[model samples]
Target: MEQGSHLLFWKAVNTVILIAILYYLLKKPISRFISDGINSVVSRFEKIKQEKEEALNLLKEAERKSQEAKEEAEKIIKYSQELAEKEKQQIIAEAKIAAERVIKMADEEIEKEIYKAKEELKKFAAKKAVELAEEKLKVAIDVESNKKLIESSLQKL
Candidate 1:
Protein backbone atom coordinates (compact mmCIF):
# COMPACT_ATOMS: atom_id res chain seq x y z
CA MET A 1 0.00 0.00 0.00
CA GLU A 2 1.00 3.60 -0.47
CA GLN A 3 1.72 5.90 2.57
CA GLY A 4 -1.33 8.18 2.01
CA SER A 5 -3.75 5.31 1.92
CA HIS A 6 -2.26 3.81 5.05
CA LEU A 7 -2.69 7.13 6.96
CA LEU A 8 -6.36 7.54 5.84
CA PHE A 9 -7.16 4.05 7.02
CA TRP A 10 -5.75 4.79 10.52
CA LYS A 11 -7.80 8.06 10.68
CA ALA A 12 -11.01 6.18 9.81
CA VAL A 13 -10.31 3.60 12.54
CA ASN A 14 -9.70 6.33 15.08
CA THR A 15 -13.06 8.06 14.17
CA VAL A 16 -14.97 4.79 14.62
CA ILE A 17 -13.34 4.15 18.06
CA LEU A 18 -14.27 7.65 19.30
CA ILE A 19 -17.95 7.28 18.18
CA ALA A 20 -18.30 3.92 19.86
CA ILE A 21 -16.85 5.14 23.13
CA LEU A 22 -19.30 8.12 23.22
CA TYR A 23 -22.32 5.97 22.53
CA TYR A 24 -21.40 3.53 25.27
CA LEU A 25 -20.86 6.31 27.82
CA LEU A 26 -24.24 8.14 27.08
CA LYS A 27 -26.57 5.11 26.59
CA LYS A 28 -27.76 4.42 30.19
CA PRO A 29 -28.35 8.06 31.15
CA ILE A 30 -30.33 8.83 28.00
CA SER A 31 -32.51 5.75 28.39
CA ARG A 32 -33.14 6.49 32.07
CA PHE A 33 -34.11 10.09 31.30
CA ILE A 34 -36.60 9.00 28.59
CA SER A 35 -38.19 6.40 30.89
CA ASP A 36 -38.58 8.85 33.78
CA GLY A 37 -40.22 11.41 31.42
CA ILE A 38 -42.70 8.78 30.15
CA ASN A 39 -43.60 7.80 33.74
CA SER A 40 -44.20 11.47 34.69
CA VAL A 41 -46.46 11.99 31.68
CA VAL A 42 -48.54 8.87 32.54
CA SER A 43 -48.89 9.98 36.15
CA ARG A 44 -50.07 13.41 35.09
CA PHE A 45 -52.61 11.88 32.69
CA GLU A 46 -54.02 9.62 35.45
CA LYS A 47 -54.32 12.58 37.85
CA ILE A 48 -56.25 14.55 35.23
CA LYS A 49 -58.61 11.63 34.62
CA GLN A 50 -59.32 11.33 38.36
CA GLU A 51 -60.02 15.05 38.56
CA LYS A 52 -62.48 14.81 35.67
CA GLU A 53 -64.33 11.95 37.37
CA GLU A 54 -64.57 13.94 40.59
CA ALA A 55 -65.94 16.92 38.68
CA LEU A 56 -68.62 14.76 37.07
CA ASN A 57 -69.62 13.36 40.44
CA LEU A 58 -69.90 16.87 41.86
CA LEU A 59 -72.06 17.93 38.93
CA LYS A 60 -74.42 14.99 39.47
CA GLU A 61 -74.72 15.75 43.15
CA ALA A 62 -75.50 19.36 42.41
CA GLU A 63 -78.21 18.32 39.98
CA ARG A 64 -79.80 16.05 42.54
CA LYS A 65 -79.79 18.80 45.14
CA SER A 66 -81.34 21.20 42.66
CA GLN A 67 -84.15 18.77 41.90
CA GLU A 68 -84.86 18.32 45.58
CA ALA A 69 -85.00 22.06 46.04
CA LYS A 70 -87.47 22.38 43.20
CA GLU A 71 -89.71 19.72 44.70
CA GLU A 72 -89.64 21.43 48.07
CA ALA A 73 -90.54 24.74 46.51
CA GLU A 74 -93.51 23.20 44.75
CA LYS A 75 -94.78 21.69 47.95
CA ILE A 76 -94.49 24.99 49.73
CA ILE A 77 -96.35 26.79 46.99
CA LYS A 78 -99.16 24.23 47.05
CA TYR A 79 -99.49 24.51 50.79
CA SER A 80 -99.61 28.27 50.59
CA GLN A 81 -102.29 28.18 47.95
CA GLU A 82 -104.41 25.79 50.00
CA LEU A 83 -104.05 27.95 53.06
CA ALA A 84 -105.03 31.04 51.12
CA GLU A 85 -108.11 29.34 49.70
CA LYS A 86 -109.23 28.21 53.10
CA GLU A 87 -108.80 31.67 54.49
CA LYS A 88 -110.80 33.14 51.65
CA GLN A 89 -113.66 30.73 52.26
CA GLN A 90 -113.65 31.46 55.96
CA ILE A 91 -113.67 35.18 55.34
CA ILE A 92 -116.57 34.92 52.93
CA ALA A 93 -118.57 32.85 55.38
CA GLU A 94 -117.92 35.30 58.17
CA ALA A 95 -119.01 38.18 55.95
CA LYS A 96 -122.25 36.43 55.11
CA ILE A 97 -123.00 35.86 58.78
CA ALA A 98 -122.26 39.45 59.59
CA ALA A 99 -124.56 40.67 56.85
CA GLU A 100 -127.38 38.48 58.10
CA ARG A 101 -126.97 39.76 61.63
CA VAL A 102 -127.05 43.35 60.44
CA ILE A 103 -130.21 42.75 58.44
CA LYS A 104 -131.94 41.16 61.46
CA MET A 105 -131.00 44.08 63.65
CA ALA A 106 -132.39 46.53 61.09
CA ASP A 107 -135.67 44.61 60.87
CA GLU A 108 -136.12 44.66 64.65
CA GLU A 109 -135.46 48.38 64.76
CA ILE A 110 -138.01 49.05 62.05
CA GLU A 111 -140.66 47.02 63.90
CA LYS A 112 -140.04 48.97 67.10
CA GLU A 113 -140.42 52.28 65.25
CA ILE A 114 -143.68 51.12 63.67
CA TYR A 115 -145.11 50.11 67.07
CA LYS A 116 -144.17 53.48 68.58
CA ALA A 117 -145.84 55.35 65.71
CA LYS A 118 -149.08 53.35 66.17
CA GLU A 119 -149.17 54.10 69.88
CA GLU A 120 -148.77 57.84 69.21
CA LEU A 121 -151.60 57.78 66.64
CA LYS A 122 -153.97 56.07 69.11
CA LYS A 123 -153.21 58.70 71.76
CA PHE A 124 -153.85 61.54 69.32
CA ALA A 125 -157.20 59.99 68.26
CA ALA A 126 -158.34 59.59 71.86
CA LYS A 127 -157.48 63.25 72.68
CA LYS A 128 -159.38 64.50 69.60
CA ALA A 129 -162.41 62.38 70.49
CA VAL A 130 -162.54 63.80 74.01
CA GLU A 131 -162.37 67.36 72.72
CA LEU A 132 -165.10 66.70 70.14
CA ALA A 133 -167.39 65.17 72.72
CA GLU A 134 -166.92 68.18 75.04
CA GLU A 135 -167.66 70.61 72.24
CA LYS A 136 -170.85 68.71 71.27
CA LEU A 137 -172.13 68.70 74.84
CA LYS A 138 -171.50 72.44 75.25
CA VAL A 139 -173.42 73.25 72.10
CA ALA A 140 -176.41 70.90 72.73
CA ILE A 141 -176.97 71.73 76.36
CA ASP A 142 -178.41 75.34 76.63
CA VAL A 143 -178.70 77.05 80.00
CA GLU A 144 -182.33 76.08 80.42
CA SER A 145 -181.67 72.46 79.40
CA ASN A 146 -178.75 72.24 81.79
CA LYS A 147 -180.94 73.50 84.68
CA LYS A 148 -183.60 70.88 83.90
CA LEU A 149 -180.96 68.14 83.75
CA ILE A 150 -179.56 69.27 87.10
CA GLU A 151 -182.99 69.25 88.74
CA SER A 152 -183.74 65.76 87.38
CA SER A 153 -180.40 64.49 88.53
CA LEU A 154 -180.98 65.84 92.02
CA GLN A 155 -184.39 64.22 92.25
CA LYS A 156 -182.98 60.85 91.15
CA LEU A 157 -180.23 61.15 93.70
Candidate 2:
Protein backbone atom coordinates (compact mmCIF):
# COMPACT_ATOMS: atom_id res chain seq x y z
CA MET A 1 0.00 0.00 0.00
CA GLU A 2 2.80 2.37 0.73
CA GLN A 3 4.48 1.74 -2.63
CA GLY A 4 1.21 2.26 -4.57
CA SER A 5 0.63 5.62 -2.92
CA HIS A 6 4.13 6.82 -3.78
CA LEU A 7 3.74 5.75 -7.38
CA LEU A 8 0.36 7.62 -7.73
CA PHE A 9 1.90 10.82 -6.40
CA TRP A 10 4.71 10.72 -8.95
CA LYS A 11 2.23 10.08 -11.79
CA ALA A 12 0.11 13.11 -10.80
CA VAL A 13 3.16 15.36 -10.68
CA ASN A 14 4.28 14.18 -14.12
CA THR A 15 0.80 14.90 -15.66
CA VAL A 16 0.75 18.43 -14.20
CA ILE A 17 4.24 19.21 -15.56
CA LEU A 18 3.27 17.97 -19.02
CA ILE A 19 0.13 20.13 -19.05
CA ALA A 20 2.10 23.26 -18.07
CA ILE A 21 4.72 22.67 -20.80
CA LEU A 22 2.03 22.28 -23.51
CA TYR A 23 0.25 25.44 -22.34
CA TYR A 24 3.44 27.48 -22.48
CA LEU A 25 4.27 26.27 -25.98
CA LEU A 26 0.75 26.80 -27.62
CA LYS A 27 -0.62 30.04 -26.07
CA LYS A 28 0.96 32.60 -28.47
CA PRO A 29 -0.11 30.79 -31.67
CA ILE A 30 -3.74 30.38 -30.47
CA SER A 31 -4.03 34.03 -29.49
CA ARG A 32 -2.57 35.16 -32.83
CA PHE A 33 -5.06 32.97 -34.80
CA ILE A 34 -8.04 34.36 -32.82
CA SER A 35 -6.97 37.97 -33.31
CA ASP A 36 -6.47 37.48 -37.06
CA GLY A 37 -9.95 36.00 -37.39
CA ILE A 38 -11.49 38.90 -35.43
CA ASN A 39 -9.64 41.43 -37.59
CA SER A 40 -10.90 39.77 -40.79
CA VAL A 41 -14.53 39.86 -39.52
CA VAL A 42 -14.27 43.51 -38.45
CA SER A 43 -12.84 44.60 -41.83
CA ARG A 44 -15.61 42.78 -43.73
CA PHE A 45 -18.22 44.48 -41.50
CA GLU A 46 -16.75 47.92 -42.24
CA LYS A 47 -16.80 47.25 -45.98
CA ILE A 48 -20.48 46.24 -45.83
CA LYS A 49 -21.38 49.35 -43.86
CA GLN A 50 -19.62 51.61 -46.40
CA GLU A 51 -21.42 49.94 -49.28
CA LYS A 52 -24.78 50.46 -47.54
CA GLU A 53 -24.06 54.14 -47.08
CA GLU A 54 -23.11 54.53 -50.76
CA ALA A 55 -26.29 52.82 -51.85
CA LEU A 56 -28.40 55.13 -49.69
CA ASN A 57 -26.69 58.16 -51.13
CA LEU A 58 -27.35 56.94 -54.65
CA LEU A 59 -31.01 56.42 -53.80
CA LYS A 60 -31.30 59.97 -52.53
CA GLU A 61 -29.68 61.35 -55.67
CA ALA A 62 -32.03 59.38 -57.89
CA GLU A 63 -35.03 60.66 -55.94
CA ARG A 64 -33.87 64.24 -56.40
CA LYS A 65 -33.48 63.74 -60.14
CA SER A 66 -36.93 62.19 -60.34
CA GLN A 67 -38.48 65.15 -58.57
CA GLU A 68 -36.73 67.57 -60.91
CA ALA A 69 -37.95 65.69 -63.94
CA LYS A 70 -41.52 65.79 -62.66
CA GLU A 71 -41.32 69.53 -62.16
CA GLU A 72 -39.91 70.04 -65.64
CA ALA A 73 -42.67 67.96 -67.15
CA GLU A 74 -45.29 70.04 -65.37
CA LYS A 75 -43.77 73.22 -66.70
CA ILE A 76 -43.79 71.86 -70.21
CA ILE A 77 -47.43 70.87 -69.89
CA LYS A 78 -48.36 74.30 -68.60
CA TYR A 79 -46.53 76.02 -71.43
CA SER A 80 -48.19 73.84 -74.01
CA GLN A 81 -51.61 74.53 -72.56
CA GLU A 82 -51.00 78.26 -72.62
CA LEU A 83 -49.84 78.11 -76.20
CA ALA A 84 -52.91 76.17 -77.19
CA GLU A 85 -55.18 78.66 -75.49
CA LYS A 86 -53.51 81.55 -77.25
CA GLU A 87 -53.84 79.85 -80.59
CA LYS A 88 -57.49 79.18 -79.92
CA GLN A 89 -58.15 82.82 -79.11
CA GLN A 90 -56.34 83.97 -82.22
CA ILE A 91 -58.27 81.57 -84.40
CA ILE A 92 -61.56 82.66 -82.92
CA ALA A 93 -60.74 86.30 -83.49
CA GLU A 94 -59.74 85.64 -87.09
CA ALA A 95 -62.94 83.72 -87.71
CA LYS A 96 -65.04 86.58 -86.33
CA ILE A 97 -63.30 89.13 -88.53
CA ALA A 98 -63.76 86.98 -91.61
CA ALA A 99 -67.45 86.52 -90.82
CA GLU A 100 -67.91 90.24 -90.43
CA ARG A 101 -66.17 90.90 -93.73
CA VAL A 102 -68.41 88.38 -95.50
CA ILE A 103 -71.51 89.93 -93.95
CA LYS A 104 -70.46 93.40 -95.07
CA MET A 105 -69.87 92.21 -98.62
CA ALA A 106 -73.29 90.54 -98.69
CA ASP A 107 -74.99 93.72 -97.41
CA GLU A 108 -73.22 95.83 -100.04
CA GLU A 109 -74.32 93.43 -102.77
CA ILE A 110 -77.96 93.60 -101.50
CA GLU A 111 -77.93 97.42 -101.53
CA LYS A 112 -76.63 97.50 -105.09
CA GLU A 113 -79.37 95.08 -106.26
CA ILE A 114 -82.08 97.17 -104.56
CA TYR A 115 -80.85 100.38 -106.26
CA LYS A 116 -80.80 98.70 -109.69
CA ALA A 117 -84.39 97.40 -109.21
CA LYS A 118 -85.66 100.84 -108.20
CA GLU A 119 -84.08 102.43 -111.27
CA GLU A 120 -85.64 99.78 -113.58
CA LEU A 121 -89.12 100.31 -112.03
CA LYS A 122 -88.92 104.07 -112.50
CA LYS A 123 -88.01 103.71 -116.16
CA PHE A 124 -90.84 101.31 -116.77
CA ALA A 125 -93.39 103.60 -115.12
CA ALA A 126 -92.24 106.59 -117.19
CA LYS A 127 -92.63 104.64 -120.48
CA LYS A 128 -96.07 103.33 -119.52
CA ALA A 129 -97.30 106.87 -118.66
CA VAL A 130 -96.15 108.23 -122.05
CA GLU A 131 -97.98 105.42 -123.92
CA LEU A 132 -101.23 105.95 -121.94
CA ALA A 133 -101.19 109.71 -122.57
CA GLU A 134 -100.74 109.24 -126.33
CA GLU A 135 -103.63 106.76 -126.54
CA LYS A 136 -105.94 109.08 -124.59
CA LEU A 137 -105.13 112.01 -126.87
CA LYS A 138 -105.95 109.98 -130.02
CA VAL A 139 -109.37 108.91 -128.60
CA ALA A 140 -110.54 112.26 -127.20
CA ILE A 141 -109.32 114.82 -129.88
CA ASP A 142 -110.31 115.13 -133.61
CA VAL A 143 -108.81 117.05 -136.57
CA GLU A 144 -110.89 120.22 -135.74
CA SER A 145 -109.61 120.22 -132.10
CA ASN A 146 -105.99 119.85 -133.24
CA LYS A 147 -106.42 122.84 -135.67
CA LYS A 148 -107.95 124.95 -132.91
CA LEU A 149 -105.14 124.00 -130.48
CA ILE A 150 -102.45 124.98 -133.07
CA GLU A 151 -104.16 128.42 -133.91
CA SER A 152 -104.47 129.21 -130.22
CA SER A 153 -100.80 128.32 -129.50
CA LEU A 154 -99.72 130.53 -132.49
CA GLN A 155 -101.93 133.55 -131.44
CA LYS A 156 -100.59 133.35 -127.89
CA LEU A 157 -96.97 133.33 -129.06
Candidate 3:
Protein backbone atom coordinates (compact mmCIF):
# COMPACT_ATOMS: atom_id res chain seq x y z
CA MET A 1 0.00 0.00 0.00
CA GLU A 2 1.35 3.36 -1.09
CA GLN A 3 0.20 6.41 0.93
CA GLY A 4 -0.16 9.77 -0.80
CA SER A 5 0.75 12.87 1.18
CA HIS A 6 -1.08 14.88 -1.35
CA LEU A 7 -4.56 13.39 -0.47
CA LEU A 8 -4.01 13.76 3.22
CA PHE A 9 -3.08 17.37 2.92
CA TRP A 10 -6.08 18.08 0.72
CA LYS A 11 -8.44 16.49 3.34
CA ALA A 12 -7.01 18.53 6.17
CA VAL A 13 -7.43 21.73 4.18
CA ASN A 14 -10.98 20.82 3.17
CA THR A 15 -12.05 20.12 6.77
CA VAL A 16 -10.71 23.42 7.96
CA ILE A 17 -12.51 25.31 5.18
CA LEU A 18 -15.81 23.58 5.93
CA ILE A 19 -15.55 24.37 9.64
CA ALA A 20 -14.84 28.03 8.90
CA ILE A 21 -17.78 28.31 6.48
CA LEU A 22 -20.20 26.65 8.89
CA TYR A 23 -19.13 28.88 11.76
CA TYR A 24 -19.52 32.04 9.67
CA LEU A 25 -22.75 31.17 7.79
CA LEU A 26 -24.89 28.97 10.15
CA LYS A 27 -23.54 28.77 13.72
CA LYS A 28 -23.73 32.50 14.45
CA PRO A 29 -27.34 33.04 13.20
CA ILE A 30 -28.61 29.89 14.92
CA SER A 31 -26.94 30.75 18.19
CA ARG A 32 -28.20 34.37 18.03
CA PHE A 33 -31.79 33.23 17.36
CA ILE A 34 -31.69 30.79 20.27
CA SER A 35 -30.24 33.45 22.59
CA ASP A 36 -32.94 36.00 21.58
CA GLY A 37 -35.68 33.45 22.18
CA ILE A 38 -34.31 32.63 25.66
CA ASN A 39 -34.14 36.33 26.55
CA SER A 40 -37.73 36.91 25.41
CA VAL A 41 -38.98 33.96 27.50
CA VAL A 42 -37.10 35.22 30.58
CA SER A 43 -38.55 38.75 30.12
CA ARG A 44 -42.09 37.39 29.77
CA PHE A 45 -41.65 35.34 32.94
CA GLU A 46 -40.52 38.46 34.83
CA LYS A 47 -43.58 40.44 33.61
CA ILE A 48 -45.96 37.73 34.80
CA LYS A 49 -44.23 37.63 38.16
CA GLN A 50 -44.61 41.39 38.58
CA GLU A 51 -48.29 41.24 37.64
CA LYS A 52 -48.89 38.49 40.20
CA GLU A 53 -47.22 40.53 42.93
CA GLU A 54 -49.42 43.54 42.08
CA ALA A 55 -52.54 41.38 42.21
CA LEU A 56 -51.60 40.07 45.63
CA ASN A 57 -51.12 43.61 46.94
CA LEU A 58 -54.53 44.65 45.61
CA LEU A 59 -56.13 41.67 47.28
CA LYS A 60 -54.57 42.57 50.60
CA GLU A 61 -55.83 46.15 50.37
CA ALA A 62 -59.32 44.95 49.59
CA GLU A 63 -59.33 42.68 52.60
CA ARG A 64 -58.30 45.53 54.85
CA LYS A 65 -61.11 47.77 53.53
CA SER A 66 -63.64 44.98 53.98
CA GLN A 67 -62.62 44.57 57.61
CA GLU A 68 -63.01 48.30 58.18
CA ALA A 69 -66.49 48.26 56.68
CA LYS A 70 -67.53 45.38 58.91
CA GLU A 71 -66.37 47.24 61.99
CA GLU A 72 -68.31 50.34 60.96
CA ALA A 73 -71.45 48.31 60.43
CA GLU A 74 -71.16 46.79 63.90
CA LYS A 75 -70.79 50.25 65.47
CA ILE A 76 -73.91 51.48 63.66
CA ILE A 77 -75.88 48.50 64.88
CA LYS A 78 -74.85 49.20 68.45
CA TYR A 79 -75.85 52.83 68.16
CA SER A 80 -79.23 51.91 66.79
CA GLN A 81 -79.77 49.46 69.62
CA GLU A 82 -79.02 52.17 72.14
CA LEU A 83 -81.50 54.52 70.48
CA ALA A 84 -84.15 51.84 70.51
CA GLU A 85 -83.64 51.25 74.20
CA LYS A 86 -84.03 54.96 74.94
CA GLU A 87 -87.21 55.13 72.91
CA LYS A 88 -88.62 52.12 74.72
CA GLN A 89 -87.96 53.75 78.08
CA GLN A 90 -89.59 56.97 76.94
CA ILE A 91 -92.65 55.10 75.76
CA ILE A 92 -92.93 53.31 79.10
CA ALA A 93 -92.74 56.61 80.98
CA GLU A 94 -95.45 58.16 78.83
CA ALA A 95 -97.68 55.12 79.33
CA LYS A 96 -97.27 55.32 83.10
CA ILE A 97 -98.21 59.01 83.13
CA ALA A 98 -101.26 58.37 80.97
CA ALA A 99 -102.42 55.56 83.27
CA GLU A 100 -102.07 57.79 86.36
CA ARG A 101 -104.08 60.56 84.72
CA VAL A 102 -106.82 58.13 83.70
CA ILE A 103 -107.01 56.73 87.27
CA LYS A 104 -107.30 60.20 88.77
CA MET A 105 -110.05 61.14 86.30
CA ALA A 106 -112.02 57.97 87.09
CA ASP A 107 -111.79 58.69 90.86
CA GLU A 108 -113.05 62.25 90.38
CA GLU A 109 -115.98 61.06 88.25
CA ILE A 110 -116.97 58.45 90.86
CA GLU A 111 -116.94 61.06 93.67
CA LYS A 112 -119.15 63.44 91.62
CA GLU A 113 -121.64 60.62 90.92
CA ILE A 114 -121.87 59.74 94.67
CA TYR A 115 -122.48 63.35 95.72
CA LYS A 116 -125.24 63.82 93.07
CA ALA A 117 -126.93 60.55 94.10
CA LYS A 118 -127.03 61.67 97.78
CA GLU A 119 -128.58 65.03 96.85
CA GLU A 120 -131.24 63.35 94.72
CA LEU A 121 -132.11 60.90 97.58
CA LYS A 122 -132.52 63.76 100.11
CA LYS A 123 -134.82 65.77 97.77
CA PHE A 124 -137.05 62.73 97.09
CA ALA A 125 -137.33 61.87 100.82
CA ALA A 126 -138.30 65.45 101.78
CA LYS A 127 -141.00 65.59 99.07
CA LYS A 128 -142.54 62.26 100.19
CA ALA A 129 -142.60 63.30 103.89
CA VAL A 130 -144.41 66.54 103.10
CA GLU A 131 -147.12 64.67 101.13
CA LEU A 132 -147.65 62.12 103.96
CA ALA A 133 -148.06 64.86 106.61
CA GLU A 134 -150.69 66.65 104.48
CA GLU A 135 -152.64 63.36 103.99
CA LYS A 136 -152.66 62.63 107.86
CA LEU A 137 -154.03 66.08 108.76
CA LYS A 138 -156.83 65.79 106.19
CA VAL A 139 -157.86 62.35 107.63
CA ALA A 140 -158.11 63.65 111.24
CA ILE A 141 -160.26 66.71 110.35
CA ASP A 142 -164.00 66.87 109.38
CA VAL A 143 -164.90 68.73 106.21
CA GLU A 144 -167.94 70.64 107.84
CA SER A 145 -165.80 71.79 110.83
CA ASN A 146 -162.75 72.73 108.84
CA LYS A 147 -163.48 76.52 108.88
CA LYS A 148 -164.62 76.59 112.61
CA LEU A 149 -161.52 74.55 113.72
CA ILE A 150 -159.26 76.82 111.88
CA GLU A 151 -160.83 79.97 113.46
CA SER A 152 -160.79 78.52 117.01
CA SER A 153 -157.14 77.36 116.71
CA LEU A 154 -156.14 80.76 115.38
CA GLN A 155 -157.89 82.57 118.33
CA LYS A 156 -156.31 80.29 120.97
CA LEU A 157 -152.80 80.91 119.67
Candidate 4:
Protein backbone atom coordinates (compact mmCIF):
# COMPACT_ATOMS: atom_id res chain seq x y z
CA MET A 1 0.00 0.00 0.00
CA GLU A 2 2.87 2.40 0.70
CA GLN A 3 4.46 1.72 -2.66
CA GLY A 4 1.16 2.39 -4.54
CA SER A 5 0.63 5.65 -2.73
CA HIS A 6 4.14 6.80 -3.52
CA LEU A 7 3.69 5.99 -7.18
CA LEU A 8 0.38 7.90 -7.37
CA PHE A 9 1.97 10.92 -5.79
CA TRP A 10 4.72 11.01 -8.38
CA LYS A 11 2.28 10.62 -11.22
CA ALA A 12 0.17 13.54 -10.02
CA VAL A 13 3.24 15.77 -9.78
CA ASN A 14 4.31 14.86 -13.31
CA THR A 15 0.89 15.66 -14.71
CA VAL A 16 0.88 19.07 -13.04
CA ILE A 17 4.36 19.92 -14.37
CA LEU A 18 3.41 18.87 -17.88
CA ILE A 19 0.22 20.97 -17.81
CA ALA A 20 2.12 24.03 -16.59
CA ILE A 21 4.82 23.69 -19.25
CA LEU A 22 2.33 23.28 -22.04
CA TYR A 23 0.22 26.23 -20.90
CA TYR A 24 3.27 28.49 -20.73
CA LEU A 25 4.44 27.39 -24.17
CA LEU A 26 1.08 27.75 -26.05
CA LYS A 27 -0.76 30.60 -24.28
CA LYS A 28 0.43 33.49 -26.55
CA PRO A 29 -0.45 31.67 -29.81
CA ILE A 30 -3.93 30.72 -28.60
CA SER A 31 -4.64 34.23 -27.38
CA ARG A 32 -3.41 35.74 -30.65
CA PHE A 33 -5.59 33.38 -32.71
CA ILE A 34 -8.70 34.21 -30.65
CA SER A 35 -8.13 37.94 -30.94
CA ASP A 36 -7.50 37.72 -34.69
CA GLY A 37 -10.75 35.77 -35.14
CA ILE A 38 -12.70 38.38 -33.18
CA ASN A 39 -11.11 41.22 -35.22
CA SER A 40 -11.99 39.50 -38.50
CA VAL A 41 -15.62 39.09 -37.38
CA VAL A 42 -15.78 42.76 -36.35
CA SER A 43 -14.36 43.83 -39.74
CA ARG A 44 -16.97 41.80 -41.57
CA PHE A 45 -19.75 43.41 -39.53
CA GLU A 46 -18.40 46.89 -40.36
CA LYS A 47 -18.26 46.04 -44.05
CA ILE A 48 -21.90 44.93 -43.92
CA LYS A 49 -22.89 48.15 -42.20
CA GLN A 50 -21.13 50.26 -44.82
CA GLU A 51 -22.79 48.33 -47.64
CA LYS A 52 -26.19 48.90 -46.02
CA GLU A 53 -25.54 52.65 -45.87
CA GLU A 54 -24.48 52.75 -49.51
CA ALA A 55 -27.55 50.82 -50.55
CA LEU A 56 -29.80 53.24 -48.67
CA ASN A 57 -28.13 56.20 -50.34
CA LEU A 58 -28.60 54.61 -53.74
CA LEU A 59 -32.26 53.97 -53.01
CA LYS A 60 -32.79 57.59 -52.03
CA GLU A 61 -31.09 58.80 -55.19
CA ALA A 62 -33.26 56.54 -57.30
CA GLU A 63 -36.39 57.85 -55.65
CA ARG A 64 -35.32 61.43 -56.23
CA LYS A 65 -34.58 60.74 -59.87
CA SER A 66 -37.94 59.07 -60.29
CA GLN A 67 -39.72 62.13 -58.93
CA GLU A 68 -37.75 64.40 -61.25
CA ALA A 69 -38.64 62.23 -64.21
CA LYS A 70 -42.31 62.39 -63.34
CA GLU A 71 -42.18 66.16 -63.07
CA GLU A 72 -40.35 66.49 -66.38
CA ALA A 73 -42.87 64.25 -68.10
CA GLU A 74 -45.71 66.41 -66.85
CA LYS A 75 -43.98 69.54 -68.07
CA ILE A 76 -43.44 68.04 -71.49
CA ILE A 77 -47.04 66.96 -71.75
CA LYS A 78 -48.26 70.42 -70.76
CA TYR A 79 -45.98 72.09 -73.29
CA SER A 80 -47.14 69.77 -76.04
CA GLN A 81 -50.78 70.45 -75.21
CA GLU A 82 -50.20 74.19 -75.27
CA LEU A 83 -48.45 73.99 -78.60
CA ALA A 84 -51.26 71.89 -80.04
CA GLU A 85 -53.85 74.36 -78.85
CA LYS A 86 -51.97 77.27 -80.37
CA GLU A 87 -51.62 75.47 -83.65
CA LYS A 88 -55.32 74.62 -83.66
CA GLN A 89 -56.26 78.23 -83.06
CA GLN A 90 -53.90 79.41 -85.78
CA ILE A 91 -55.33 76.93 -88.24
CA ILE A 92 -58.87 77.98 -87.40
CA ALA A 93 -58.00 81.65 -87.85
CA GLU A 94 -56.36 80.95 -91.19
CA ALA A 95 -59.40 79.00 -92.34
CA LYS A 96 -61.67 81.92 -91.39
CA ILE A 97 -59.51 84.35 -93.34
CA ALA A 98 -59.54 82.10 -96.36
CA ALA A 99 -63.32 81.74 -96.13
CA GLU A 100 -63.77 85.51 -95.97
CA ARG A 101 -61.48 86.01 -98.95
CA VAL A 102 -63.41 83.46 -100.95
CA ILE A 103 -66.70 85.14 -100.01
CA LYS A 104 -65.38 88.52 -101.05
CA MET A 105 -64.20 87.15 -104.35
CA ALA A 106 -67.58 85.50 -104.92
CA ASP A 107 -69.38 88.77 -104.21
CA GLU A 108 -67.14 90.65 -106.66
CA GLU A 109 -67.74 88.00 -109.28
CA ILE A 110 -71.54 88.22 -108.74
CA GLU A 111 -71.46 92.03 -109.09
CA LYS A 112 -69.41 91.82 -112.28
CA GLU A 113 -71.80 89.24 -113.77
CA ILE A 114 -74.77 91.49 -112.83
CA TYR A 115 -73.14 94.50 -114.53
CA LYS A 116 -72.49 92.46 -117.68
CA ALA A 117 -76.12 91.29 -117.75
CA LYS A 118 -77.45 94.84 -117.34
CA GLU A 119 -75.26 96.13 -120.16
CA GLU A 120 -76.39 93.28 -122.45
CA LEU A 121 -80.07 94.06 -121.62
CA LYS A 122 -79.57 97.73 -122.44
CA LYS A 123 -77.90 96.89 -125.78
CA PHE A 124 -80.72 94.53 -126.65
CA ALA A 125 -83.36 97.12 -125.83
CA ALA A 126 -81.58 99.75 -127.95
CA LYS A 127 -81.35 97.31 -130.87
CA LYS A 128 -85.05 96.42 -130.58
CA ALA A 129 -86.01 100.12 -130.47
CA VAL A 130 -83.96 100.85 -133.56
CA GLU A 131 -85.64 97.94 -135.40
CA LEU A 132 -89.11 99.18 -134.33
CA ALA A 133 -88.30 102.71 -135.53
CA GLU A 134 -87.14 101.36 -138.85
CA GLU A 135 -90.40 99.39 -139.25
CA LYS A 136 -92.48 102.47 -138.40
CA LEU A 137 -90.53 104.70 -140.74
CA LYS A 138 -90.89 102.20 -143.57
CA VAL A 139 -94.68 102.17 -143.12
CA ALA A 140 -95.02 105.99 -142.89
CA ILE A 141 -92.76 106.92 -145.85
CA ASP A 142 -94.34 106.84 -149.43
CA VAL A 143 -92.39 105.15 -152.20
CA GLU A 144 -92.35 108.33 -154.42
CA SER A 145 -91.00 110.53 -151.56
CA ASN A 146 -88.22 107.93 -150.69
CA LYS A 147 -87.13 108.00 -154.37
CA LYS A 148 -87.02 111.82 -154.48
CA LEU A 149 -85.06 111.98 -151.14
CA ILE A 150 -82.49 109.42 -152.40
CA GLU A 151 -82.07 111.30 -155.71
CA SER A 152 -81.47 114.60 -153.91
CA SER A 153 -78.89 113.03 -151.40
CA LEU A 154 -76.96 111.59 -154.41
CA GLN A 155 -76.78 114.99 -156.10
CA LYS A 156 -75.35 116.58 -152.89
CA LEU A 157 -72.66 113.82 -152.65
RMSD of each: 3.6, 4.5, 4.4, 5.5
Those runs of model 2 whose alpha carbons end farther than 4 Å from true positions after fitting are: 1-29, 124-157
Q: In model 4, where do residues sit more than 4 Å from their true spots?
A: 1-19, 128-157
In terms of lDDT, model 4 sits at: 0.97
Off by over 4 Å in 1: 1-19, 132-157
For candidate 3, report its TM-score: 0.71
The lDDT leader among the candidates is 4
Task: List the candidate numbers ranked by TM-score, top first.
Answer: 1, 3, 4, 2
Q: Is candidate 1 or candidate 4 better by lDDT?
A: 4
Provide the lDDT at 81 for model 4. 100
Which residue pairs overlap in candidate 1's backbone?
A: none
Best by TM-score: 1
In candidate 2, position 85 carries an lDDT of 100
Which whole-number lDDT from 0 to 100 does residue 12 have in model 3?
92
Computed on alpha carbons, the lDDT of every model, listed in order, comes to 0.96, 0.96, 0.93, 0.97
lDDT by residue for model 3 (66-103), tens: 99999999999999999999999999999999999999
TM-score for each candidate, following the candidate numbering: 0.73, 0.65, 0.71, 0.69
The lDDT of model 2 is: 0.96
Better of 1 and 4 by TM-score: 1
